[model samples]
Target: MSRHIQDRIGRRLSTVFPCPDAVEDTSRLGQVLLRLAQALAPAPAGNPVPDSFRTDLLAAVPQLRRYALAQCRNAAEADDLVQTTLMRAWENRSRFEPGTRLIAWLFTILRNAFLNQRKRLRREVEDVDGAFAATLSLEPEQERRVELIQLQAALNTLTAEHRETLLLVMVDGLLYEEAARVLGCRTGTVKSRVSRARERLALALGTD
Candidate 1:
């Protein structure tokens, strides 16, 4: 990567992984970083995936993982979703417009893959009883852990539209116009959904 492109990727990564306690944070951001390093390992010779594509994908990983985790609420499954998204993006990379927001395009792909997966598994029973949560080892900071749990639970209560909109606009830092493009809606609609999602989240967290 050129120095300018490297700097740009660094900027995006900082935005996505801004937490000083990211390694110790209970939100699984650390896992995303680890997987990112693994994911960017050099593609084998004869592999058609372009280097620029790989660079852009690397920059998008943090946002993609964060969005996936919010959608699925399972770290492992969310990682799988991101992997699937990357594969699809690589396969169809020729269709992507140059100079556009690559993260937004990847988000659209990830969201579609997740929705398809949900449809396929609609009849199956998920971990509805917090079994996975029970297995996670919490840190020594009880208050912060409890707060994160509370926030995650609040996020879970949001409708799918609200949650998707909130994460795309609020968490992922997409412009309303870009978010609307990802969500297949008008800009005004994106703004409305984000407003309602914020209201709902605040109400759920008792911050309103």
Candidate 2:
């Protein structure tokens, strides 16, 4: 890669410096060494991932996001899935082999993670068409007066964590990853809070 690319990635990844160009070598060991260097460059900011490795991560983001979007079909869920994949990949980077396809490895992790999430939500009914509001069976639940007042009161009763997650994901239309970025927590934590908050709201409103 060019020095400009390296320097740009260095800034983006919070690395203090750029890396030297790889020496020409056709040998397998040389190839492995180069790959390892790119995969594990030391960060000057005390981050484990250096500019070289971080470039790889940044390069993979778009593709990873596409895969996530395909799997979840929900922007928020897709962003959460992508964040989970990246976090897990960072934690388990040592398990990645040098000279192998890093993108393939990341894609594998994304697929597995998506499937696991699907398993967790399998029992719950999803409203893909936004039809839930039209299907309310109770007259009181459909009434505007009761809904506006009672729902507001119930929301006021939620813990800060639960309320924020619900509003961020539901009202603001932000992805879980975006909310997590704003909230300084993992996407899974945001997901849990939203779930709990919804349950609490349901219980308070006599909807569950």
Best by lDDT: 1
Cα lDDT, all candidates: 0.66, 0.55
Alpha carbon RMSD to native, model 1: 9.3
Per-candidate clashes, comma-separated: 0, 0
The lDDT of model 2 is 0.55
Q: How accurate is candidate 1 locally (lDDT)?
A: 0.66
Residue 118, model 2: lDDT of: 73
Give the TM-score of each candidate.
Answer: 0.62, 0.38
Per-residue alpha-carbon lDDT of model 1 for 108-208, expressed as tens digits?
Answer: 99988988898898843232234324534455688645644554565556566776776677667789999998888999999888777666545543453
What is the Cα-based lDDT of residue 44 in candidate 1? 75
